[model samples]
Target: MHPGVKTKEPDKMSPPEKMFPVLLQKNYVPQGEYEIVGYLKEAVKVKNAVGQMVIVEPEEFVKGEMKPHESPGVGFGPMEMKDGRKVNAKIWAGTTIKVPVAEAKYVVAKKIAERADDIAA
Candidate 1:
């Protein structure tokens, strides 16, 4: 035993236990409760008086394509928040976020409402 280091007695330690449950079947699907981890962009299209269609307008919009993270070993990894914070949650394709079933429905509804015009068209 080293004099500089302190050691704990075996009797004082707690018994070992599993943190997560073990699955009996190998074909089990996990519940959706994850966060989206990647870059995103919000784009809007406006129609002019002459009915001209424009894709990218620098003056009125910051146009850019939505790009995802392309790093290996990032499958079902953590997601980055709008406030530049990284959350420890598994996500899919860095786009479709696997959130709670109820929350997922809410998110979809909210998005549809926000893009009502696009849907109508």
Candidate 2:
């Protein structure tokens, strides 16, 4: 073959597998099927069986229930109205809560996944 001439040959191997471990953020962790919806440089978007989307790391998997972490705080509402005039009202006490967070786990890929690049999470 001449230096300027080139021959066409099939690639030795296909595209490298993009195996990723997904993390699910749910109130309760039930062993079920999960799918990736979107992808990011550092994170991935995953869709659960219930149609809930969660963003997680690219190379990590989290499956379990969330842990409760509560911090008590006082809350006050808007002022009271009296006779079409703004007046001071008694300070109302209340509590606000936030959702729990689950720990992230690293899952190792045992085999090459098909169409793994398509999945975000």
Candidate 3:
């Protein structure tokens, strides 16, 4: 250690990449009551049954090439304010989140059944 040298300040650290859990069942889905606790650049985070968290983009979750029946969804709905306008939730860069999945109530079942019927047809 040099006696006359001044100590340098430590650099600030950036946040780690967030991750969410993957629910791999047709009956699992995100509900419409959840809120986005954090925002990421084109990504969202969620926890799975095994306690593993993962990150995903809005397009990957909402409108990507991935089939809705195959991947999980972020359980959130359009948010309406007192101004009579609805706000759609989004994930931006550096957002932390906890995505929840609900039991596929009916629509998912109908879609699966419809697909099966289409195959038969």
Number of backbone-clashing residue pairs for each candidate, in the order shown: 1, 0, 15
Question: Best by TM-score, which number?
Answer: 1
1-121: candidate 1 lDDT, tens digit per residue:
8899988667876664322211111111224434332233444467778898665634331222213335765444446899997766432221423344454445445442111112333
Which tens-of-lDDT digit does each residue in 4-101 have in candidate 3?
99898886885633333232223323343333332213447788788997765453333222222223664434567999887654323222233433
Shift of residue 105 alpha carbon in model 2, Å: 18
List the candidates' TM-scores in order. 0.22, 0.18, 0.20
- Cα deviation at 112, candidate 1, in Å, is 7.2
Using lDDT as the yardstick, the better of models 2 and 3 is 3
Which ten residues in a row are the worst by lDDT in model 1? 20-29
Pairs that collide, model 2: none
Cα lDDT, model 3, residue 15: 60
lDDT of 3 at 76: 38
Ranking by TM-score: 1, 3, 2
